[model samples]
Target: MILNSSLLVSIEKHFCGNELLNGEMYMEGIKHYLIDMDGVILQGTKLIPGAAEFIQRLRTKGASFLILTNNSRYILRDLQVRLHDLGLEVPQEAIFTSALATAQFLHTQRPGGKAYVLGEAGLTTALHDIGYILTDQKPEYVVLGETTTYSFERITRAIRFVMAGARFITTNPDVTGPGEGGIVPATGAVAALISAATGAKPYFIGKPNPLMMRTALRTLDAHSEDSVIIGDRMDTDIVSGIESGLQTILVLTGVTTREQVERFPYRPTWIHKSVADIEVEG
Candidate 1:
């Protein structure tokens, strides 16, 4: 009703709920959702008890969601195959990874810089798609992600380049990521080892940095208040969601245990055992 500053202050003393200080109103609604892949959706080789059914219900309700993961070992297609095999419907476009986020950051930071990659085809493909010139010969940057083919030689080369003043960047800072067998060293651990040797810390561009979350949000075109992020890791997923101004829901079906949540610095808005326990009120 076009209330002025003075009137707004006056109304605030008595206004609440559906009415704001200026007679404006706001209500939280769920429009888009971002979910963590490994723990929240599926754990190891099995889908979480109710994750698939929950997603189906969300789809039927016309809510859009993207499966966001900090695991950069697999590309979008790889993840899609895994999800499909689990009987969950997930499109490649609905998958976002730290590899993609790192590539995007590099594209903006140094468009044509030559990068030395220390990861699998996922990170390489992501960099190539973003128009970066990847090379091992006198690279201008050392891009690190999770790699199963890690070796002392690759580490030595990356350190050499970084020591020679090449920019260093990592997809995420997760020391160990959840795997089919158990926790395994992620890109963060590898990045740290390199940084320790070269004394050059890599800029992290994945979860908890807000870059990946923002990119996912842009892809969905979802308003901050109208969205929620569900994940298992408090350090990456939950923290990133909170930082990006989205409601955070921590599911106990993944890495972070129930007791761990209380000790976490950033507390989620809600906690559940799995998607099965959640009721999408929006």
Candidate 2:
């Protein structure tokens, strides 16, 4: 949604408890919110407490927000369907995935470039949407993204491709992720294997690399100073938000615990038990 001055003022009055009536004063109350999906909104297939209501509140208040995720297994439509099943009605346009970010990064770095992609529908679909040709025939890049099953042949091919002078790229640096059975190796783990074999480090295009955050902000037409990022992980979401110059809120309903937060060298702008405890109205 397009945020105008009047809308900003109204939101400020509702949340900030200030009726300064000036656009500048209202703008200080957060024009956009970048929210993480996995930990902060859902744990595995279940929705976190107050996640649906919090999203609804944002929609009802006409606040601009994006559900950002690093998992590149499912496309936007698939993710929307999953959220819908959990009773969370999020618009497809408001969802941003690391695969999409990687695709955007590639498009800017080398428009219409070809790559040997080792990923699922999310990554392949994003690359296809951006007109990136996926092939193993002397590709410019060997792009790696998350998948439930990492095939030995695919990893071998990716290693060979990288050794053949193809630059390596990955969606995110998450070494492990939650699975129905338990924790499973993710993109970062596979990337490490390829790196070990090929001695080529993959450029991570997802969280902790401010590029993804900046891209999401650009998509929402948001200013970093007037935006807030809500996430559960300090390593990925929080650090990315901070590096992107956005205010960060760390929620403890996911991988990060209250005790673990103290171990980080940097701190978020705000801390909460979960999305349930966050107050839009100050």
Candidate 3:
């Protein structure tokens, strides 16, 4: 059955009321939350103030949540360790990445196609885990994700392969990601650069793409009315949550600032400066 647009708008307006009233959310009850990593939970290497405690509170109240990220350079296990180190108790299955979504998409569609991957161990491992073979030896597809070892040679090779009729795929289109040394180039930048060179557009698998969100909902077995998606970016997080039929909360700790939000065409259901400012009462 098709969902109603007016219902979505009403849900959005209700959530936005929390932002208008400043930091407090007094809804009926929320059962699940999909949270972002870099900006909403932590800025760079440090945890966002009170995020760990907020998560602990959610857990104490028996709420279901997942950590969703557009970053594809790290796998679920990697993110689990990182969040644990930051004092947030997150399970491996509760972590979802664009890489995982891309891998899932590839598994259902291509099955066992040979792929030329221009990414780090994360993307390679994801492809391998999904039974896709990795090869630079005339592959059927060119996969782009974040790689610290990105070289001009690698980009040139990817472009050459795509130009030779290889299909292209990407994890997400985030131009940059927040890191310890300020912002660094993300997988999307590399994809754009290669797309420009090869004259072939790549299909994105993360944020704003419903695959990951659908997977998350299935994993959690939760409905849209009982859940909310929180993140720092608008194009990725806000758009994804809105499209996925969930309430949206934009935290201003990482990429998009308050002024930038005003300039954007879309708006989140709620906006907060940091997770520290969000207090959910039982």
Per-model TM-score on C-alpha atoms: 0.86, 0.89, 0.87
The better candidate by TM-score, 1 or 3, is 3
Candidate 1 lDDT by residue in tens digits, 1-282: 686764453233222321332322221477788988888998788999999888887878788888887777787888899999989987798888989888878878888779999888889999999888889888988888887778999889999999998989888888886666777877888888988888888889888898888888888888766788899888888877767777677899888987997696556776778888766644
- Candidate 2 lDDT at 135 equals 91
Instruction: Output the better candidate (1/2) by TM-score.
Output: 2
With a 3 Å backbone cut-off (N, CA, C), the pairs that clash in candidate 3 are none
Candidate 3 per-residue C-alpha lDDT over 1-282 given as tens digits, one digit per residue, 9 for 90 to 100: 875986666555645665675755554467888988878897777788989888887788788888888778887778888888978877897787778888888988889889999887778888999899999999999998886778999899999999999999998888876656677888878888988887888999888786778777777898877788889888888877777777778888877998898787667777788877766546
| Runs of candidate 1 exceeding 4 Å displacement | 1-28, 178-182
Return the lDDT, model 3, position 87: 80
* Candidate 2 residue-wise lDDT, 28-132, digit = tens: 477688999988999888999899888877777778999999999899999999999998998899999999999999999999999999999999999999999
Clashing pairs in 1: none
| Model 3, residue 10: C-alpha shift (Å) | 6.8
Residue 148 lDDT in model 3? 71
lDDT of each: 0.80, 0.86, 0.81
**After best superposition, candidate 1 residue 21: deviation in angstroms?**
22
Candidate 2 stretches greater than 4 Å from native: 1-28
Model 3 misplaced stretches (Cα beyond 4 Å): 1-24, 179-182, 280-282
